[model samples]
Target: MNYISAEQLTKSYGVKFLFKDISFNINEGDKIALVAKNGSGKSTLLKIILGREIADGGEVIVNKDIQVVLFDQEISFDGEDSIEEFMMKLDSAPINALRNYHQSLYSTDTKFIEEALAEMEIYKAWDLENEMKQILSQLKINDLSVKMGMLSGGQIKRVALAKLLTETRAEHRHTLLIMDEPTNHLDVEMVEWLENYLSKEKITLLLVTHDRYFLDSVCDIIWELEDQKLYVHNGSYATYLENKMIREENLSATIDKANNLYRKELEWMRRQPKARTTKSKSRIEAFYETEKVAKTNTSKESLELNFEMKRLGKKILELRDISKKYGNTIILDDFSYQFQRGEKVGIIGKNGVGKSTLLNIIQGLENYDKGEIETGETIRFGYFSQKGLQYKEDERVIDFIREISDNFPLANGKTISASQFLRLFLFDDQTQYSLISKLSGGEKRRLHLMYVLYQNPNFLIFDEPTNDLDLPTLTILENFLAQFQGTVAIVSHDRYFMDRIVSHVLAFEGNGKVKDFTGNFSEYRQYKSQQEKAGISETEKIAEEKPQTQKSKKRLSYKEQRELEQIDKRLPEKEAQRQIVMEQLNNETDYEKITLLSEKLEALTSEIEMMEIRWLELQAVLED
Candidate 1:
């Protein structure tokens, strides 16, 4: 059954239509992703559905007994209220009323009190309390129970989410939960916990997020709001993308065929050599009619983003033992790193871990204490600050781009046309005239990206570039970054974006120590896990094992001795062979030669492995 339905829904702010003629039906057990550029009315549409905002023109039909919960980005907590009190506030009126009635009856009649108590027990208030405790514990928010009202924004969001989840579970309600940018303030572990919970729960969800991993893991459908319309694509975000491309290709072919027919009609009309009669004029009109239909069928072309940076010397940028201090707080300490030419590095850390500060220092926008920084002669850096161009509220979009373009030389040695350049970034026609203040967050981000790309810098630094972008635009940005030839450094909390664009990860844990991983975010996580396992203290392991070091030594004696001798003899040969293979692998472009060398290396490795196995067997025999 359709739980909620919207038909002919239209909304606008002044003369601009946020979205119009949107119609879709959401059923039970549906997990839908509401995706659009930031400020493209995603929040407004949610409000309209909740009846908090009146739609300009639409019919919203909701099923009876349907309950909706919305998690907005701006969270407000009552300072004087306790966490328990807040949870109670989220409870349905009937639940509260029933509890009150039961308490009153408990003083009146013995039988009534017994029955009321039974009802309360069946309602599972005890289980709700326990579940709340468990959730708070998992989120590490239990410690903030007493200070919930005074907690940071991120902490408050977690508290709100906990209350929301508790209320829905307590009521045993089939509810539709709307979340807007819920992952914005969540840590990776918290996000994983949320995803796991949502995946197991039985609730209809409509979420707006830039977190691609969350979308792929949680949503079964994607409702893409673009160009004043809603495009419903079934399946995960990845599947939606694949299907969208197929649809675009089909549309392109149909448009091409239509254009050919229209051209043929025009050619025939020109060959008439006389003023067109009514029939000929009608045929020309028919051609235009066909063209109109074709136009409607055509998909909008994506912006052609060609990012070419001038070649820089081998040493693009280097930071030697960099450190930064703010007041008494140390943001970065002894962080040494280097970015080589063509290296795509991603910077990740918890909020306020100096990811942005490091980027600023690299870009020469900020000064750092106790560090040596170097840049290549041909290296040019472009910085996309977190605020982007959104901070300039009064500026027009075209004027902003025009001002930035003044520093760059055009193709003909003339000033670059602001309108033309902005159009390449998907600000076409009337959109060029839109005020920066009026533009959506995603639009402002795109404008900023265009500005950075126009610089033709060899080194690009983006701070949370995917924050408010739509899914399509995010894909476009991902493609551009993947194809970019220059060194790129990005500070993003979006794991999906990081994984797609970066080949290396620079994680800034607190205390100024940075860890560099050779692969993307996912790979970095795996590497971190391995390091954690390897760091397990011997004392802890001993506590779980037989006490004496003598027993351990005796158990390992023979194998340890044999392996020690084997390693002593084999190490030099293995090292020599490994070095030779590495050198050849570096220069050998021929796949067949590389494959042969890899096989030979594998055989050498197996011989060392066999020696270790034999040594282990000898150790076991000696112990016996």
Candidate 2:
């Protein structure tokens, strides 16, 4: 069944056309990804389809029978409302019933609770409510009572995501889910989980994201919006790329032929006398058409970075047993690493796990409690943050860029004006003159990146720099960083970006622990999976390999030996309990009981895995 069909859609901003006379169809179970350069109307197209925005010309028809859920890039809410209250505001029958039922559990009003309970039964929202709780839990939204204003942008985005997913799953069979930049604020783990969830579920989806890895894994169809047109590819991202290259190459060859014919036609026209003949007039018209095709650009242009980096001394930056804490939470503990002259390290972990804290400490922006930091005398630092570019709404893009420098110096000692530099980053003359508030999210991100690179710092620190960037800009940035001759450190959730730029990975496990691997993100993930299969964590394996200070290796204590024996004895019992709960879950017809049994089974399985890992740790200690 076709959920949506768009015909001859035309949209433009100001005098610039975003897409013109574009037609596309979204059918049932079509996992489509919309990709384009920044400011190319990807989000605008989605808005038009959803009726949030009007198209200049053309029509969009959506099946009224199917439920539609949108996870927008921008989230808005009443600041005073709590998370639960915010969820209740959604005009979804099942969701409103579920939210009211949940809110009633914290109330002392018996009559109100009874009414809410009756409504819940009418909607059969018990299973949905349970699923909602699980979704919130996995997204780390623990405090449903927190005021909307108290949450950070990332937190708000997560809540919006939870709400969208819960609604989608509630109407999973008949839902058409549309999301824009859904992975922007998500961590690597969360992105991976979401990728798996979307790929495994039978939900129709259309989303715009710069996360190529997620797109490759979750989407079976790719839509490329370029030059006021839409090109559809019926395959994964990799397949789309391959086909796109072939298309570009064929276009290039065709253009070359056109150019050759245009030269001949031009010579013939020039050789003809100033006499007006019907045959010559017809030939002249044909020549003009040939010239048009000859002048057509074969592919999108990408800028190459050849900027000279500042000299780095041998010492570089180093942290000696650095430790930091905020109240009871330890952000970093006894962390020590020396930066080499030219090294790129990617930092990844769960949200609020000290990845940003580490970057701040390295730059001396944040102080550490128990360690010393050293930096080379000649080093210069450039920091790009997740907080993004802060500028007055009325400030022009060119003015903001000019604040850095009127002239940007290249590697060959040549200087280009600030306007030229902005153009290199794809900001046209009109766009550069426009106010900052007029730019798209991706456009703003590109400007921010241009600001960072203009400084020409020898040491670069980027925190979630890929949040609102489009794929083409990401590719350019990745290529620039990969060729950079400076020391680099990044904290990002973009797996494809990390894989392309970084040479090492730092896995920040919570509680102030970090595991370093000398490989790219993909390699690190593979190594981590292997370690987990061997009953060891990445941190444990790294710790075991560290140089020993004492002549004798440490042995398991008496208490540890007893604990190991206890784990061995408890494992079988927990496994048996898990089996019993699983069987009950399969046989239970009661929705409430099934939810309870599933939770019990999950907990039991986690306990058993913990015991087994403990057994392995204990055995390793004894062997040492």
Give the poorly placed runs of model 2, Cα more than 4 Å off: 99-122, 271-275, 392-395, 415-417, 537-547, 551-624
Estimate TM-scores for all models.
0.74, 0.83
Clashing pairs for model 1 are 333-512, 559-619
Predictions in order: lDDT: 0.74, 0.84
| Candidate that would win on TM-score | 2
Question: Would you give me the overall lDDT of model 2?
Answer: 0.84
Q: Write the per-residue lDDT of candidate 2 for residues 25-93, one digit (tens) a residue.
A: 999989999999889898888888889899999999988888777898778899999987886666667
Candidate 1 residues lying further than 4 Å off, grouped into runs, are 10-21, 37-41, 54-58, 78-88, 93-123, 137-142, 145-152, 267-285, 294-315, 323-333, 360-371, 375-380, 388-393, 406-416, 509-512, 530-624
Model 1, residue 442: C-alpha shift (Å): 2.9
lDDT of 1 at 530: 50
Cα miss at 353, model 1 (Å)? 3.9
Candidate 1 has its poorest 10 consecutive residues by lDDT at 541-550
